[model samples]
Target chain A: MIRVDENPEDPQTVNELIEILSIQLNEPVMKSTARLMIIISLALNKKLTFTDLLEITSLGKGSLSNHLDKLKEGGLINIKTVFSGMGPRVLIEITREGMLAYENYSKILKKLLSH
Target chain B: MKETPMDLSDHLKKVGKEVVRLDFYLLKRAFGVYYATWAAAIFTLTILSYISGITEQSDTYLTLYGLLDIGVIIVAVDYTRIVFRKAHMLSRLESDLQMSKSFKTIGNNVNIGILIVLIVMFAIIGTNIFPGDLNSLLTFIILWIVDLYVYMVTRISFGKVQPEVILAVGTFGFSNTASCLEFLLTGNSVYSFPLWLVTVIGWSISSLYSFYKAGEIHSTEIGESGSRFS
Candidate 1:
């Protein structure tokens, strides 16, 4: 929290605040629009597979995998990989941490911007 | 801070709503398919009615409906196929979700009660329509009851509220309302045939759309999560 005496409305203060908020976001949740989309999409639907996400997000192979790795590393989601007749299937499920982070992020964003 | 901060509550609200919307993605798509099927069904019925000489109605309108219905059903199917062929993942997701426990949930006691009530209401209307012909009335009632079950099953195939299902239900409601009015007015000449035409059209579209989508979904390979995206 920035001190009121420090002029919360200052550009520097706002930039710092933005940075702070960005840092607080879940590892898989921040900066990239695709990451946020992934989290939001997972939060909305409890579970999704690679193909499902591919169809929904229209994200390419490398980009989706990169975001998934970050999310997976941050303990935001669980990625399960296995084989099927069509080839490989990757299922992505949002963890409780990821869900809470997403909800909190949405709330905080609304709060920050609502003024 | 100088300029008034843009109010984004509405935008936030929209984003929040998008989550809900995404949740119903497959359902909405399924609805388009439903409309296509309903058109085909109505066309078929009109042709059959015309052939049997069941009513003194204009054969031209009925024949026109058949042609239009067939055309629309074919187009909707092709559109669905085109968009969804590469996106087989969507079809799989829809089918898997539909086959899940939610589909079975509708078969419980409460729905059955509602089903019974609907059956009774339609039966009264059917009986009134056929007048002294008890056999025809019975047949009409039985057929409607079967259709009601189909309607319910189709509606719940993917946890309800597929756009197609809603349209189909609305169509049914329209026809029934017309039937009730017809019963009050004269109750003798199948005055609700027009409404029935609308009803079958709606169902045929709903049915074909749902069927193909579900069919596509079922075609996907299902097993352990694959290494590719799992």
Candidate 2:
């Protein structure tokens, strides 16, 4: 049998092992459906509105609004109100915190994909 | 072959339904912006007119202002009705987001254009490009152009009734700037160029703050998936 070392300090083996561990740690949080929805929506456009989210996800108004509220509260989105001909409209955009979360999540996903 | 034709029809029907839904959502989102802007414009104009002595309680000026006020109110109420009628079909937050983004983009472009023209008008007046009477006439012409441009752009961009909301707010700023400058140049009023400069500085600072805030918000929503907050 080929010689094998069980020591965690084995450089090549340790690196691989650490990478595997990282993937496991990152996957569940980043890969969650709610996170995915937000990520996909923002990725497709630099901004998303409530109605746009509904169109993209085909989710009901209340459900989508709840998700948006959670995202906003989580510091994952920013909403602004502007006047139009019809009424006061809310514009939803992503925030730096949201971007960081997505980035970290993506790194985890990448690690998972690579392994 | 029979199955293929039927499947295509079903797909088309689904698409048709989706389009209708999207249209409704867009209308409501647009309406929200309209009402807010209208209210803001009226409030700002009333205050500015009072401060500038334009509201001297003259019959003509008062009548003119009253008519303008009534017009905006009518527009706002009518647009609100239209939006509410279609609101039920919207049933989606994302749709509103998309419409809002489009409106913001259009608004930014229009705002930039208005600022540029105002700057040009100021430069021309300062340099005596035309006599006083002609200058006033030219100013009116520019105002009309600005109004027309804002109306056309908002209507085209929103694809519904024209929302004069943004135009109203912008017009307030433009008028304020012009009136203040005119007062400084002609009346040598207490309000100096420095004050005007300060106003510009204030605008620039606030604008930057808003932009930074928007960037921060955008990044958070995107969450590293290269997503954009709408």
Candidate 3:
């Protein structure tokens, strides 16, 4: 295969290189709509609750609940439950790992523009 | 107690949209890192060859270079397979979305770190900055093992064991061992085969053991979270 630097500015070559890079950096968690929105919101807010996530994203109860579970399992978000007067309410926060992934994703977006 | 049909449909549509957006974000990130690394590797190799005058035009050198090129191509193909597999898993989660948040977050972070390390390795090797010595080989092996371990831990924690994760671990193991053997065959005495071989074997064994342990943890918590959601 021709090396990348040989024709770095060639549009076709650049496109191929971009294609390969896209494959390597793609994250499974980032592909879910609910997860992405929650991540963006969490990044903006630093922390939120399940109800807050639902209200912000306008996701239904089942969809929000299911996506939140997946995000939690993936370590993208953290849930801290506290007992209030009525019942236990959970506060969701993006973990350090999640923030890193978000940052990485943001970096990728910047690259695409430069390319 | 009951959700209207329109409500359910609207909810599913929203979920689908979220999945698409996430896919776009991931694809962009993966491609960006990959291209930058490729460009840097090629540039470094070209510069090193020019400086060292190491381009011995012998038949033996040409044959060995061809073999190395083939090996790299194989690795690239395997990497593509991994990318596709992860993409497929994400698509499935769009519908099921049953995976754990912690696992996904951890997996993404690990993936990014590994890619960065890989780019660095490519640059270092291409530049011939670090001779193929025992210390360098040991560092490569240690990093490979760590990457595999992190991958396995993420998989087990997520409760969704995609074949891609196992494939990645296996591929990294095979490549690391093969590279070491290649060094040995080249008569490089910088590394002791006995010690490096043992380290590789130990890491491989421990990685598998941890994988099983992770599986157990996942199974235990499978349905436990469902009740909380309800």
Best by lDDT: 1
Q: Rate the local accuracy (lDDT) of all candidates.
A: 0.53, 0.46, 0.48
**Candidate 3 — number of clashing residue pairs?**
31
Candidate 3 Cα lDDT to native: 0.48
lDDT head-to-head 2 vs 3, winner: 3
> Top TM-score: which candidate number?
1
Candidate 1, residue B36: the lDDT equals: 55
Model 3 TM-score, all chains together: 0.32
DockQ of each: 0.05, 0.02, 0.03
* Cα lDDT, model 2, residue B164: 34
Q: Docking quality tier of candidate 2?
A: incorrect
Instruction: Please give the range of 10 consecutive residues that has the lowest summed lDDT in model 2 chain B.
Output: B221-230
Candidate 1 deviation (Cα RMSD): 15.1
The candidate, 1 or 3, that scores higher on DockQ is 1
Query: By DockQ thresholds, what CAPRI class is model 1?
Result: incorrect
> Candidate 1, residues B1-230: lDDT per residue as tens digits?
22122323333334444333343444444445545544565555545544544655577867875676567656754654433321222222333223434434434333457557765875576456654645444544554564565455545435454666666777876776665555556654343456677787777766676666654543442112111122
Candidates 2 and 3 compared: the better one by DockQ is 3
Question: What would the per-residue lDDT of candidate 3 be over residues B1-230, giving only the tens digit for each residue?
Answer: 44333343344345434434433333323323333332233333323333334445667765765565556555544554444344434433332333234555566556567666766765566676665584567556665755574455435333466443454455445545665676667754333333334334444444454455434433443213211111
In model 1, what is the error at residue B158, expressed in angstroms?
16
Model 3 chain A is weakest, by summed lDDT over 10 consecutive residues, at A21-30
